[model samples]
Target: MRLIAAGLLLFGTLAPTLAIPPPTKPPCCPRHEVFTECGSSCPATCNSILERNANRVCPDICVRGCVCREGFVRNRDGKCIPPDRCGRDGHRPGDSSEEESGIRCHRPNEVFSECGSACPETCDSIVKGGSERKICTKNCVIGCTCREGYVRNADGECVLPEECPRHESSEESTKCAPNEVFSECGTACPDTCANLDDPKPRPCTRNCVIGCICQEGFVRNDEGQCVLPSQCPNSDAIASSSLLLAPLPECGPNELYNECGSACPETCDTFNGLVENRACILLCVPGCFCKDGFVRSKDGQCIPPSECPKPTGSTPTIEIITPECAINEVYSQCGSACPATCETISGRSPPRVCPAVCISGCVCRAGYVRNAAGKCVPPYECESNPECGPQEVYRECGSACPPTCRNVLNPNLEIACIDKCVAGCFCRDGLVRHHNGKCVSPKQCRIPIGIFTVGSSEELNAE
Candidate 1:
């Protein structure tokens, strides 16, 4: 009875300790920062306007960090500041005052501008006479450019059209070979001996191309030499020569000799299925083809469609032989052109647009992706997203624009985000990513203290 009483006393002493849960670790962050697991890969900064206007592509990913509180953007010094004060101190490019002070037009007939034309007229462009279309970017470019009627010369100086140095005409310098001639624009497809008698009008581009071609009344021969039509070998002579050289193969019954035959000829086995969907090459094959209303049989004999053997049942049982695939993979006759690989699955570099084309092969099944070793596996099994940080979980298709401390307070920043999902680590609900790389509640985010300045007086003086 004494021993039993002692055991009961020990049990009561340890009961409370065992029932207690582990203490949660508080997030560590600097002043005015809060932890978050799902932060914008492309966070809004003082240069966000410039980057967005410049058409910079932002990576689709969720980053973990301690970001600034709402109604703020990161400045050059990594401090949160108001959006209105982004370019007030002249750090931004193309600033009016900065352009005026930094660039000086020393050359004659030159002027400076904050937003200059991207495609400025040059001596070379003037010489081309607008033959080629110039693709210009619709953005502000700060630089010194030639004045109104002047153009930039090869020596990098602005000059009048008449004052620019002249060169010999390209047509005068070009010397055509024996049967070739120079032309400002030439036919893309030239006539040859094979197509000389063909009545079909070949499709060609209307664009002008300058190059040498056979003289008028001549065509390229088999040896690639320009020859007149009278000098070309006659069909009878060529046929006789070929017969003397080698005898032609005897065609089977109902088959005829054809120089150009359909590569995907109708067969007894494929007449009901593959023949309808198969893609045939434009190039023709040289062989004997079966007569109309007949198809090649399994025994290499041509037979009528009605004479072909029919299925025994009303519903034919097509035995589809599925290919053996690796783990988490499935065979598909028309698979996606862009399959989910390790890089795409991890959102390292996902395709912006996938072509609508069919590719036959073994591919990863739904909810699975291919790994680095080329084996299909579940998305969670991928090595890239397996090491998610605290309070974060791996997602195959998370939001491209996740809520961060910078947008958590406002929640309606007029930033355009791609309407696509990305694979990455995302924070749990009610937690926001802080600038210092931690996940914490939104209320824990601290508001920045004191007024923000661009730079110190000493630094400005040094500059």
Candidate 2:
């Protein structure tokens, strides 16, 4: 009886241990995989179609542990995929296949390849017939290449080498002088010594022109020769050289000879406000100009400015009126180019660096900025606007890269933040923006699935 009681007590203690099943081992099979006691010896894979077509055989056997689900095969990445996607080619959809047997090249006499030459012979290269050898890169590229005895044409089609179009040589029937080169497309406004010292900007036709152009660092001279800029004759030398031809004609009173005179000469009729804003061609005109304090008469004679004719109409006294301005605005002869607006009233924006030129307009008064309604308002009024949400403050200049729930937990993440400020509502201090565009405390921030917590709240808050 004593042995039976001891045995019963021992069995009772062991029964509880046996009743609790062993902690189930975590599943080792990844996604798209299942544990199997008996798996196919030769399961379908990315290369199954090619292998089957080659009459490859599969031995009757079992593969235990894990296998892909039905109708799915393992790709090169060991991920199960559909049978139709087996032996798929490029990294993107609709791309040409790299498989030798399944490739469907678009152009004739072309074949697809997994590894081909980076630089292939083209029709243009063959037509040019240069003795220089092409330096091809060794990097492998997956694309279509022309078959033997064929080359890629300009139209991106593979054609026989003899079918390339012939181009006329630009140098044929054309001769280039020293320091000049023949170009199929040259600039219409070739640099010349006459215009080299001119400060005005000139417009030229944007067209492909065939002609001879001066070589680099050289310009054309008046004698039609390409020479270095230092070799060009100066103004005094040119004037002395021209003296050999003929003496300049004598000028009238208050007149002088000008190699390049103003096209819009000041005349008696236009001395006043008659032609104040007239547009004239900015070109050099060789003629005589009036001396200082003199104007040209209609008879082409220079006279004193005081001798110019006056208008016969009666003069009326005109009153200068100041423009009426809205509230909080004042009329000024000069206004800020970078005007203060609701978007720039926070004083957090960069300092305004406006040009010294005056801009006549109605400008906001001191400590005021224009609002969305085009009315000048105080900075405090902007802060009181209802555009800001709860726990968010409106800023004229706010951080472009604001803290969000996606990056709040991982503040050390590298983000391309612009240095400039943006106008928007931003989260207040000790708060972060949520994915739903609401502001909340860091502790209340919900971490994304892939991101895990690293430390306690105090450590994160301190950071």
Candidate 3:
């Protein structure tokens, strides 16, 4: 009981001295509308802007640490005043209590925020170009840089079209024209048709070894390749084999079959002689005598055409001088002084005839004709193709461009595929073949052809 009495006395005496002023509203917002004074009933019309916002008890009804009153906001007496006297309300852009702040949430490469004062629709954020974005939308025909998971459509703006699915390759929409392809990454060409079966290596496919659209060994080079072994750049190992074998053979082409099979025996050894395995070759057998310009050796060898001297009318003196005469003695092309009747050489031989020297004969490579010079050369058109002048008399092989037409790029160009001459025909681009004498280069076009000019779209298509 004595302690209670002392506590009552202490409360009574110190209550007056400790009396504190009623709470006021924080300066961030107008006190009349949102903040309420302690112990005061929040007025129903504290601020006309917010009516029902004031009806609750003071201190707990509105914004924390704020004070509110009737018509006159919490004035100097911590009470309401006339409505006209109230200052501005609500938070500005960067108020500490403001929920939405200066930061703007935008999509990648978007310029919703603001570049200086204008809206950059086509900002390229990654490259830091103008607005840091490129416009991608139907409205913008110039096209725009698209954000992730999207691509630019024909409309020119960034939009998600079903045709271009996510994570799919761009080849579906990007294409090149024939004789063309994407120059760089992301570019498109209409002609993607590449040769699929090149048995030999070429440059375009980047030294591809197998399964290319353009032939097996060939590839689409930056410059394109249509020729033979030359397709591969110089020192291109694909041109030759490791054992010094000739280039790979493409058989039945232009009816020229040199080195046709796998690997034919290069030497004239009897054991390795195989007619089926022979390449483009024509050989003189061991028993048959060479026509001319061939020599017989003491060891029974047929000297090559290159090694033999010119064929003279008479027999060689070396065989019949002291050497025993045989019905099949090796005869060579060493005779010029003796008569053509297998006569003897005056200085060295008795009246004996000459024989063959080649136990093993010689053969010629493919692609050459047996001329009077007895040398091989590219197949000639002869009288069959008068169009093939001296400049390009060699006939196109049956395997390359067909007998129809062949158009070769200039040799000086980095990329050139087929040679200029065809098997037996030729023509220029965009020309139709009819009963004309022959298709010609633009130099021989028959018509003074050209498009007629028109003033408008309707006028052009109609006529």
lDDT of 1 at 195: 74
Measured against the true structure, the TM-scores of the candidates, in listed sequence, are: 0.32, 0.25, 0.15
Residue-wise C-alpha lDDT for candidate 3, range 327-388, written one tens digit per residue: 32333323222222201111111223423222222232333333334343334422233342
RMSD of each: 23.3, 30.9, 40.8
Model 2 agreement with the true structure over 346-446: per-residue lDDT tens digits: 43343354443445689999989898799999866865544665556776666655666666566423343445656667776656665445555555454
Q: Which ranking of candidates, highest lDDT first?
A: 2, 1, 3
**Which residue pairs in candidate 2 have backbone atoms (N, alpha carbon, C) closer than 3 angstroms, thus clashing?**
none
How should the candidates be ordered by TM-score, best one leading?
A: 1, 2, 3
What lDDT would each prediction earn against the true structure? 0.62, 0.63, 0.29
Question: Positional deviation of 235 in candidate 1, in angstroms?
Answer: 28
**Total backbone clashes of model 3?**
62
Q: How many residue pairs clash in model 2? A: 0
Q: Write the per-residue lDDT of candidate 1 for residues 260-333, one digit (tens) a residue.
A: 57756888868755334764433346678899889998798999977778745565666789888887788987
Model 3 C-alpha lDDT versus the unseen true structure:
0.29
lDDT for residue 358 in candidate 1, whole number 0-100: 59
Better of 2 and 3 by lDDT: 2
